[model samples]
Target chain A: MKHIKVFKTTMIASVVMSGLSVSSASQAANWLMLQGTEPAAAAGRAKVWGFIQAQYQKDQSDAGPTPSGEGYIPPKLIGPNLNSQQQFNVNRARLGVRGIGMPLDSRVNYFLLAEFGNNGITAPGGGDAHLTDASITINTDATRIRAGLFKIPGPEETLQAIHVFDYINFSEVSNQLMLERFPQSVDTFQGATDTPDASMGQYSRALGAVRDVGVQLFDSFQSADWDHSYAVMLGNGNGLNFGDNDDNLDTYLYWSSEMQFGGKGPRAEGLKLFAWNHSGKRTNAYNKTQEQDRKRSGVGVKYLQKPFRATFEYMQGDGMIFQGQHRPTMVFNDEEADGYYVDFGYYIPNTNWELDLRIDSYTRGENFIHPVNATLNSAASDESTFDKTTIGAQYHINKKTRINMEYSDRSFESDTATVNAQLEGVGARMAVQLTHIF
Target chain B: MKKFLMIMACLLSFSIQASPDSKPFAEKRIVLQISDPDPFKQTLVLNVANNLINHYGQDKVDIEIVAFGPGLRLLFRENANVDRIDGLTNSGVQFSACENTIKGMTKQLGHAPQLNPSAVHVSAGVVRIIDLVGEGYQLIKP
Candidate 1:
């Protein structure tokens, strides 16, 4: 009788274990929510992670002549000293630590990352290391609050996880318009006589790298089959510096809705629609007493599914615009500009190969104020349109490593025939990079 | 008394054979092991399991995913793949969470970690794999 009772008890235990069930809750996929966040249940004191990108890039454009017999300088890769046609570089090497306040309180988490690469983040200042992200987030039932130096909510290209970026270089629009470059000194040089013996020199202090010191409130939620996210941030207009340049603070707003397709992680499969705007005031270094309005806004759509991917983005800028350098002259002033890009990709079935193509165009200086003969003059610049088409291929060596190869066909345009002819020398570029995440 | 003892032995053996939570007529059994922390690997393991189910009818095959070490992150309640886990659960796939890892994490975390409802606690991930293998299941480390 005792043995029979034991048998019945064992059967009951088995039945109870097999019948276990729990209530289900809905979940959403938001990179912002997933990237730096630790799971509430397994929140650790410290977790370290990072990635490295090594690359070689070459500019194929050749110097040519303008109609006036003046030499036309072809574009060069932007780097230290800024004149290399081809070179090998450790483009990005970053390490970061992230964790929640475990035994104390899981609601608070922190993320800190540093850059040790030969790129804009460090090279501009000749520094060996640059702190890119240092932020702390507090989670609540309603929303999450993050504070410190971090990437502002804006373009998908800038907001997404950089380690998984599909391309080695950013689009022309994102590069020139979004990536803030700070000038070391004001440009006092006018035309010929007043031109400083030395050029303003490559932005000597810092590169924004699409980051700002700010405080943001953000969250993500699921409704039906879609995951929606939103963020509002207030930041110092200055790039990497912790302090604001002017009394005016930058305001950023972003929203995204993604239709989840049953995948996870940074490269999840989804169709996302997003829009964002950033507005701020910059204290002009050239005219210290004067503050210029800076505004940027964008809208885009991205889709990722098995064997196919597509992205399209359109951006606009008003007021302060970076005009880059012309000989020893540095230009930054109020201007109007716009740009757009379309990218498509295909993954070969049963293979590790993926092919991609992208077309991008940008028109700058719609209302450019030219510095001529030691005086500021209003002019409609004819040489302002830039376009490029990029063909790329990626080979996934393993889950954490991949090789990327790309060739870009570049071109320039102007209303003046001679200016257009002079820009014809602008040519193609090729780059190859290997990325590993650990 | 000898006859009664024999009958008890037979019944115990039969109960042990029927105790597995798998479909009665499953033609194939697979146990997938995930021991890496990489999110890509975690997602790939699920993809492999889905592909297997697509190839073999869900009723014809039984699948169990065993996670240990850092791979336990995949079974966290707030994991990014919560929807995928729910879908797979409804499809009859099972997820086994290693209790050993949970205890280690608890020590480091100062509190016990919460797991997805779909994940069933197992004494150890490797031992679970071994038990499944002993039951004629194929082992795949994806």
Candidate 2:
């Protein structure tokens, strides 16, 4: 243990030294700085921008029978009420206006965006319009303070501007862990039976979209050629809700150091090292008196230079894990979970084409009991593992538009053999999406 | 811990100062600002610089182009006008890149953008232009 601690210290020291040594007077910029701060030269009072993603996805596997031979469940997308084998949908339709204060005050800027899509952000609430980002930032020499509804500083995949996301779908780990889903209850035994209705207790509101109402203090500084940034935010633990559910607030801490390679805009080339931690408490929707601890943390490195780009991240969670529907019920447990993902892409030189590959794995519900049947009073300690490998390609039609095609091979495992058999023959999925930014 | 502090000190020592002092001997001093992201505008500014050099003679005139905001793209390492920038530098023309713009871009792009090696750092392009104008240099926003 002593040696391990020393080794960890040395590694951290080395990373810090490397970041400091590469410092110079000039280099790159960061996404958060660009979005939160206004440029000195003001063009207008408000500038509008947004993107739209139209997608078509199909499940490649055939419907298979469960181990019990009672019924058949078709392979579906990794979301609630999306059991269809094929569908075409506008995954995202977002529009917003952002700019400095009227009459040209660069120190104060605001960002406002709304979602008009048929995805989780709108579908769960059965609403056509949903506000995703509405924040005002006050800039000072030392730091910037932003308040309102905004994204939580978390994983790169979650924190970075979504319009430039290279993949059609998020990695499994990010989907299950970071892309939060708020259910009304944690009582798995409330309607427990031998065969519960699969859709009875599912989440009706797919809110959160990774945003919270809060205030954050963040800034980035340059040292030689490296740019280091830090953000500390205090937020209402409730996701996207205007009011806090409990007295306790969520605290988020994030730090990143990057070495610039060149380029500009969302696709710039750089090497970044980042880590973040999020801790909060969630009150059970059904049992208001009961609250569960929710904590998540991650560390990662991302490198992007011209033709080659790669990112790897490892994440861990303790308490309040979102276990997907066990046939007829959604389960939330105070259990431990961990996940990781590695993504690599290559942009063909002098061409508007890029190829991408990503692999991700997640394990949830460690040593947690699930009622097999309430009538028999039988329970089992259930655990599940999910893995996915996605191969994709992007064809850039122009600077503001691109088409992406992806094929994903997915697999699921459970400690219960019967559950494993039910998830067998889970096959590949194909998706094609076109995105245009204005 | 001691060794780590020593290395940090060494790194800090290499920090370069922003903006160079004015040249006193030059007959004419001019500062040009490029604040737009249009590629055509970028090329036009370079053309204007070339015209000024041709008319005044390279040694007789001092020219500096200060870029900020969207116009910072002109100083990008991969910019198409890299050859022109190199030619202008050889003709004694100076290029100044704004740190504010870099910071803004860094915040947006998630990293500091690589700039042309010939470009000198300035805390802010607008301030740099103001300083140059105060130093008897004519300011042009073309």
Candidate 3:
């Protein structure tokens, strides 16, 4: 309570000081409607934009050293701790600047952005600022070429800004397949019937930084009623701000089109269809450092109408992260996985209130491979699947401030003898968040 | 905890000192962009203009509205929002209509099209915006 009061006081004081400054400035300037506080600058001049997201998450999963006399321990996925724990965090603190160069030809524009927030949402480590975007665009009226660190052409949901996401947490499929980080604790499974090699755990690495260092060429084909666009990129497979970690480069391609159903401008409404391909390579087996193939493809649809919106996406991939689990001494084998999600949202006719729902699921099609010398039998035909459903509501206090509340139910099931010992369970979580844009 | 507090103090100081709002100048200049073909969006642009004029007063702020492509229709003589446009113009807001769009529309209609009398024809809407921004005019695409 005391902390909350302190935070509120500080925030109010800042806004008051800012208001005084804006009201007293004597210069002739254009005022930004949404970003009203920005200092006036010319069209070709660079300007800064950013937002902050702070949140609290509570997990209701009954996960501990072991589950109610179960013979083995299940891998932790929902919370950062080895056991379910609640947390308060600054999820994303981002800052960015973009504009056409003031002196250079108007055709040339540049953007650079960075995040000083939590590194791993469900884990430890990462209290440093990291670059998220650094791109230069040379564009004509309809076509453009962009090079540097940017988002890979993939799922539209992955490409959307986190501040705009309707749900507190992303769909299960996006979390497991796209972010790709696996649980790291071997301590919880120490007494299990089949012990994993604790020293070989891959917990040090996190997957699914959506953006990569890349170059993309994109253009649009437009008519009075529709807009069609396409983009292709080649990038270093490694996530944000880093050079390629492997010898092979990654490739991404996307195509999309929107057909207007409503009149033009803010009232213009449309339905869109999009498809993308992601192909890359990843290193497997920590000791041997063997190179392996990674491929993914997806298709989705989106509908944008005033006060209502909906999106659906499906994706499949085959990679070295055996059966979607990264563990110490895990075998390096080809595994295929697929997932999909449906999201729907609506806003109250004349209020700041909004309602939303989402369903997400993922299936791993390969066997939960076991260590070669394990004491328990490796059930080769067993498979695992995950599902999650979320119901949420949001209220826009104004254009720049918002509050969100969400409830989610998640379930995991597997048929393998090794995992059935402790893996099959259901968990529920509730979260609330506050977002401010500047 | 101490380190966190120190960081927050530094950030707040920087936020205040680095505010882009403190440039030494004689006047405030603003540009409004209407690139969407929707009349509803154009009205929103006008609303923003009115709000700014109300807050800063018409005499203190320099305002311009730039339109092109499908957005050019916002300045058509028969536009649904012509009265709103004229009202804003009366308060010193300038409107720039893109000649490139006018030419395209004229070719499509097989005759030269007419724009609202309040609009000043420009070679290109985007170029006008670029030039204005270079002169330190902040853009507000409401």
Candidate 4:
């Protein structure tokens, strides 16, 4: 009942926010100065910008039979899979103010963005007004320094803003592997607490949005036909919406080169190649003593030219979650994981239309092995693989408004403990969204 | 007491007249910053400009595109976006090239290169953006 009330409150807030006029006085440039004691400096300006995305999504999957046996399935694996569901809701309603305050003679740029679109969907930090970006960037001739809550320097798609996602949803591999594992309280693991609600495990896990509190240094060097860039970041590996959960800090490094193909200009108009690495340690919520080592590395390439673009990324990681989007059972040790995806998009010439297609594949070890006989490693019982194919279309009504429709077919390959051994099932989803920006 | 009342009335009237509803759309200013030289990103910038013009009518909106760093290539005569730039310029949009970047490029290319006829050279791109913001222009970097 309390959860329902919370949902109601969030819905009311969302409705109020949606009814707000885009040109309201609160969105005016002078509103910032008016709220503060500081005089309107000659170099300070604030611009309010954001977008609302309303979507209807539905997914249907065939579940193989449930596994039975006392020790064969861990306590954590006793519940039903939550991925087979259909939902309709506002996917995102984000509003933010970003501008230069001229604090360092305009060389220091600051941005603060928050989102209030978390009611209908189960996403990490999705249910309320949450910070998306709080960063102060200092730009210099040699390098740029950015610090605060920001997107981690990783895959191109992960770094891209959610408002500009090419499809209705992120690629399966990106959605599952690129983010930090969700933390679970010791009480929750022991079934000692009902507040988080055992059934809401998946939703709770969904809270780790792919952002971290960090500082990043980056710069770009360009030549006649190519541009090369590098960035180094240090972050608290914890998800956004909160402070660091542990004393350890995450480190990331990225390097990329973009080269123009046949273009006479120095601009990188055609091809892009990049590589990234992340190394860190994270506190295990269920067992404080087991502070886990986290590492991820990947390489990617992209071809961009006019009406056609293609991108491919391959990444591998060693962490708690294996073969799924959530953490593993305590009895099972976290294993090495790898995943990759390829995406292609084309815009219709002379029209506000576009088409997109993506294919993703991921494989990892099992989430549980009998605690007493943990060494029992069998390929038929300890591995899971997932593959997905998606195709979508988008229509741009105007610069600030867009409509997208997508269809996806997903399959899971697993060593099912089910009596029937029905390890293969296809899940399909159809989604449509309308986004308007102000 | 009469003088105090008179002063309050004048202040109220000024506040009412300064409201956004009383302001004309044509008086609004926007600055689009282009610092990345990626053609696709530059194309998105132009797309944003065209959309704003279409929505508000070119005459009702004052728009300026400020290019710096590698983004200066957008204003080159051989730029892939020159035609688009010409069309937007014809629609009353203004384009500014950073003088600092131009000087650096000239030094590197060993010649004083040419820019599109519509592009006006500014002393410095960041400083130009700051000045424009001081004048109430909304800055958008895409």
* Top candidate when judged by DockQ against the true structure: 1
Tell me the tens digit of each residue's lDDT in model 4 across A78-157. 11223224556676788877655632133466777776774312344234566777877775646768888877777877
Model 1 chain B worst lDDT window (10 residues): B13-22
lDDT of 1 by residue, A1-438 (tens): 666666676567445433222102222346677654555534456778899999998877554435441223324443443555678999899999888655234478898999998887887657888999999998876788999998888888878888888888888898778987776453333221111122223566677888899999987766767888889999997878888767889999999999889666677888999999999987767667877788999999999997999999999998776665332223346777899999999999999999999999988873323443223332456447889999999999998999999999998765644334445666788999999999
**Pairs that collide, model 1:** none
Decide which is better by TM-score, 2 or 3. 2
**Model 1: CA > 4 A from native:** A1-29, A67-74, A78-80, A103-105, A186-201, A325-331, A366-378, A381-383, A415-422, B1-142
Q: What is the lDDT of residue A419 in candidate 1?
A: 38
Q: Put down candidate 1 lDDT per residue, B1-142, tens digits, no spaces.
A: 5568558858755442322465777788899998885566777889988998899988888889999988887787656566577788777888889999999999887887766756878899999999999989899998
How many residue pairs clash per model? 0, 25, 18, 3
> How many clashes in candidate 4?
3
Would you list the C-alpha lDDT of every candidate in the order shown?
Answer: 0.75, 0.74, 0.65, 0.63
Q: After superposition, how far is residue A109 of candidate 1 from its true place, in Å?
A: 2.2
RMSD of each: 8.6, 11.5, 18.7, 18.6
lDDT of 3 by residue, A351-430 (tens): 99999999988886544444454544446555667888899999999877899999988777766645554454336778
TM-score of 4: 0.62
Interface RMSD after interface superposition, model 3: 16.9
The positional error of residue B100 in candidate 1, measured at the CA in angstroms, is 15
- In the order shown, the candidates' DockQ scores are 0.13, 0.07, 0.03, 0.03
Q: After the best TM-score superposition of candidate 4, give how far the Cα of residue A353 lies from its true spot, in angstroms.
A: 1.7
Q: In model 4, which runs have C-alpha deviations exceeding 4 angstroms?
A: A1-44, A65-84, A119-127, A186-206, A260-269, A322-333, A369-381, A416-423, B1-142
CAPRI level of candidate 2 = incorrect
**Chain A only: TM-score of every candidate?**
0.86, 0.86, 0.78, 0.76
Each candidate: chain B TM-score = 0.85, 0.84, 0.79, 0.80
